[model samples]
Target: MLLFRLMSALLGYVVILVTGKATERFVNMAASRGIYLWDITRVREGAVLLKVRLGAVKALRHIARRTKCRFHFERRVGFPFLYKRLLRRKALALGVLFFLGALYFLSSFVWFIEVKGTERLTVPEVLGAAAEAGLNRGMPKWRVEPGRVEAALEEKLPLVAWTGVYIKGAKVTIEVAERVVPDAEDNRPSHIIATKAGLVKDVLVLNGHPAVKEGDTVSPGQVLISGEIPPLEEPPKPGEEQKQGEEANKPKKPSRFVHARGIVRARVWYDGYGEAKIAETGRRLTGRSETRVSIKFKGKEIILSGDQNIPYELYETETFVKTIPQWRNLEVPVELVTIKYFEMAEYREELGIEGARSLAGERALAEAAGLVPEEAGIVNRSLEEVQTGHPENIVRVKVTVETIEEIGAESLFKP
Candidate 1:
């Protein structure tokens, strides 16, 4: 049925209103003459409406005259009529063509370029390399060959181990995998320097000359190991006085330089101070709370759920406001406000001197430990209570945390 309607509309169809005494006879005569008609509806006692293809309409006039009924076209629909109407409005047709042309032209060029999977490399660095491969923005997508672009990017960037190019519509995505090669052994002349000031506990030279030994104090930027290894000098034999002059004359062997590598363990101490009052008074949450939800519209608020009034006298409020997102200069004058009232209770405690000191010591130790690294080995921790000349209600404690860790770092030198 739908296909018949579509074919009828494609060939052009019209609805006709027939009015006369013999309207039923007119339809019967038309059906007998092999004229196709559909959607036949009776509008009134003497009036009838029906649809017929444009070709059958000319033949319907003869049948209408024989049956003594008059008919007139009520509506004309189909591709032919639509084409005639479009021909009348030339500007509309031209605008549609221009829109399609613009859309096709814009979609052919690459507009957005993105780089992914970059850890050590920067975005601009990857884009720069891609631009050198004829894969830059605004270039025609047809001109971009994925295979060539991938090869050029990999060749241009030494760190890129692999690369992939994908073109999806106007956006081109470039994904890269960086090389994960281990650092090679550095044979260049360099020195091991102290990264921080500490008391050197032990110094172990792996590939360079040691400058500091155990129980030595080192400062930041100070060289803990020398890269220049001096040549070993031998003492002269009993009768080798002339040989000493010859040895001095023989072009002295220059000192050998190497990339310094060593581990210098040092003792670093961190200090922190904390104080606790013997008598403390504060307010704390009791975990008993209630939530109230409400909606505010045009300066009027209405509670949606929960109690209208908070039950606690002393409480803390946690309010969260959710508003409808405004769009394009249109603002919604409504908001959902949720308020949580947590019951609070006043707390007062009087701790003796020993209790206060213990609490203050724990706080001070925690603060000092924050400065120590997780990889550092804990050597010692001590706390001391500070006392004033006159008695006071506060107990102040000073804590020290001592850790032993490697402090040696490579420092390049000009040999």
Candidate 2:
């Protein structure tokens, strides 16, 4: 039984591999011969299962003669009677059953959409978006294109700034980011204000009068622009037809509110601290990389790297697959794939202070350089301090940059 099982598995793989390879070679040969085979398939033990558009008979004869194999002609049909009969007889039957079972498992519609790490969004809203993206009830496994599906969902759901989708068997997984609505201004009329102290480098005014101009020095809460202005006309006196009299004739007060739109790049005095430490300290780092390929009926996850020779480490792997619907097309898999990684590696006191500090400084400097604005100037640098224990012992470096840029910004509008 075991031998038969082994043979069955081997035969299954052999058929798939041979069919794939033969189809590829046939394509290449046909292309070279100034012929085009639009469609092709391979059936090893039977008559020509595939009908090639380009040199059909000739290619068959060529292959048969080259491999010392017999060739026969047979009609292709919707129901592969001979193939089915052959497959049902032995271990091939088990493979056939397995393939059919996998197909069956993939047919059910995705019932639940479990979103992880969503704060402002509700579950129903996310699911509704998924439905809009065609990932809802009755969506075939093959038809659920995760990338396309996620994109579509994001378009309709404004709250989700970003999303990732995955499918495991019948369950569809969604990870969502909620739209962060900035705090609104008090209900009363207000003016746009500078959030920090800066010399006005530039100013744009929309919908409100400009209070500060280019080259103006301003403090926090000082209005950069004003929206609300005094009324142009006085109120009606003593209820003399207040609704329809002078009150109506009086031009409405110019609308008062914060200037709705603008970007101000200002040279602001700011302090930034970046620190690096020197020590031979080990730290745990997490790296995420995933690889995927179709295996058997379902897709399997494969890791290409990150396995290290250390004991104080942790590793985790996650896999997901969505199957396609049709089986006749051998080249296209019914299976879709995704892989996730969570790995942790730690280093101990394998080295002393100076070395660790140096490495930390290098890393921190790299980070600082990456973060620095192109036109910004470094105003100061603090000495690297070597301290025991985390972040400090790991490495510490502080850098300060002076730049003309606006950082603290808030919009008074609801959107």
Candidate 3:
């Protein structure tokens, strides 16, 4: 049905009203003469309404005269009539053509340039390389060559390992991947010092003299490895008695300094305290909430939805307000306000003395565990309960954690 209507519209069609005693004879004559007519309906005693193709309307006049029937057009439709209307309004047609031409012309130039996947390289640096290759913003898309941009980036920036240039509509995207380079080694004279007070478990000197050994106790800021090496002194021969005067006249050699590097493992201890009450009381959410939205203008509010009053006896309220944006001192006084009410219930828990003690100990241990470094190896843990003179309804626990970890840190000083 849709296809038939589309064909009728494209070829143009007309609705006509036929009247006379021979209206039926006119329809039969038109159909027999290959002039198609459809939707034939009897309107009155001698009048009939129907539709015919635009090309067949001229032939219908001769058929109506031969059958002694007269007819007039009720409505004219389809593209042929629309084309005639356009011919009468030249300015509107010209405006449409100008809009399409402007759109086509503006889309050919790049408007936006975006750089992606650049961490070590700054955006300006990447854009500078691309600009040198004729891929800058506002350049025509046809003139931009992706191969040349990629090659230029790799050549100009030695840190960039890979690059990709793509043009999508009016936006050009340049993706860059930077190479990973190791930092240069420091050769300045330094010492490895203790960052915390602990007992040294092991010490291995890589480029300096050892200051602290195994089973040695060291305090914060104490040197674990010394960067200075003293010159060795040789004893005189057994029978050389006169060499004492020559030795007294000779000058002593100076000590050599170097950059100290080493690992110092030590045993560290951490303590945490926790307390819990036998009876606990708090408020918790019931997961039931109600929301109300309204508009506020000059301190007056108009409710948009939800109830006027809060329904829950005990609840918490959260409010959010949004107002129209202001432009250079022009501001709207109206604001959209949304309020949410969350239902809350009171809760109380009762734990016996033993249960409270266990909970307090667990809390203390968890607190102590958090203080331990990730690289530390746990060696031992212990918990102790504290008691006062009077027996109370609370339990207090203290936890101690021992860990073995590296404690060496570099400390530079003037020689």
Candidate 4:
């Protein structure tokens, strides 16, 4: 019986504390709007007390000019010990929650590391590289210098040719590239060969015998300079020993050096295809004003901005579907803001044979224009034919154009 009475007293104290806090907050909020709380206390039945406030009533009366009772009246008394205990409990709960939240934010980077493009590199090697790059546990991600880290990683592992490091929230993503190995096996004896089937395009014989002269038309794989040597050197016969000795005394012919340059044109076949749909597209505005809030604890930021907004249209032939759930850094939903623009409708049309042919011709011409240099005049354009197919509504057209210009063919050998 005594325990139950004690529990009831504690419960009453908590209620009084919460009600006092709520009333205080409400009065403060109202005071900002020029309203005040007029509190009054009066003695009631012996130990009981009656408290009344007319501040809200007066404010309401001013607004309406005729109010009877806009304010609430309550009577209470004799629970000082219970009120103090409840207030303490509420404060303790609030303090504990605040502390826990702070601790969670401070130590939230205990997750796993994700290494992308690690085919050539082992996971441990990539992790080690990241550590060397200053990306480690408990370290604020933004502090990991991307430029310095990439340079350090490349210096440490020569195999990682190219690298990109991004700290997405807590995940540290590392994209890597392996070093390229050149082919060593020579089908023919290693020689200085013409790179292209051009008129010996400026041959520079570094360490070989010259075979072709300038302006000579050489085929593909043709040796511009030879590394081979004659089996034996011509020597004077038994009677010409003195003559051979005199020749040796003379300076040996300067190493057979040659520099050949020529111009040659070949029928370089090239095919280009480009596809452009009549569908709608939108470009984001750059000068538009945007407000973003970033919550950071220790260099790690929580972005409160959403991705770009694309418009959608109903009652129109074209429709753009866009959906955004939310962006979260650590299970906490970030802010989201979206703006959409509805576009006008577009009518579909069926193309006849001539229309299809004309469209195909236009596409082919556009492709050809891209292939030939802008300065190079497109003299000839021969359209083969326009072939149409069913089910897969497509028009195929082949266009051949002729232009006189220098074109490169070295990228085909690059790895």
- lDDT (tens digit, per residue) of candidate 4 on 256-317: 32222223233333344433223324333333333333344344545455333333333222
Model 4 global lDDT (CA atoms, 0 to 1): 0.51
TM for every model, in the order presented, reads 0.53, 0.32, 0.54, 0.33
Q: Candidate 2 clash total?
A: 21
The sequence of per-residue lDDT tens digits that candidate 3 reaches over residues 1-415 is 7998999999999999999999989999998998888999999999999999999998998998898899999999999987777789878778878999999999999999999998888999999989998887778899999999999999999999999998999999999999987544356778999999899999999988899899999999999999987788877678866667887889999988888999999999999888898887888899999999999999999999989999899999999999999989899899999999999999988988888999999999989999999999999999999988798878999999999999999998778
Cα error of candidate 2 at position 30, Å: 39
| Candidate 1: residue pairs that collide | none
**Cα shift from native, residue 123, model 3 (Å):** 24
List CA RMSD, all candidates.
15.2, 23.2, 13.3, 23.1
C-alpha local distance difference test of each model = 0.91, 0.58, 0.92, 0.51
Which regions of candidate 1 fall more than 4 Å away from where they truly are? 1-185, 242-252, 327-329
Error of 1 at 102 (Å): 66
Span of ten consecutive residues with least summed lDDT in model 2: 12-21
Best by TM-score: 3
Expressed as tens digits, the lDDT of each residue in 97-203 for candidate 1 is 89999999999999999899998899999898888878878989999999998998889888899999999999999999999965665776889999888999998
The per-residue C-alpha lDDT of model 3 at residue 225 equals: 96
Regions more than 4 Å wrong, model 4: 1-61, 65-96, 103-112, 116-119, 129-156, 161-169, 173-177, 185-214, 218-415
CA lDDT of 56 in candidate 3?
A: 97
Winner on lDDT between 1 and 3 is: 3
Compared with the true structure, the alpha-carbon lDDT of candidate 1 equals: 0.91
Which runs of model 3 end up more than 4 angstroms from their true locations? 1-185, 236-250
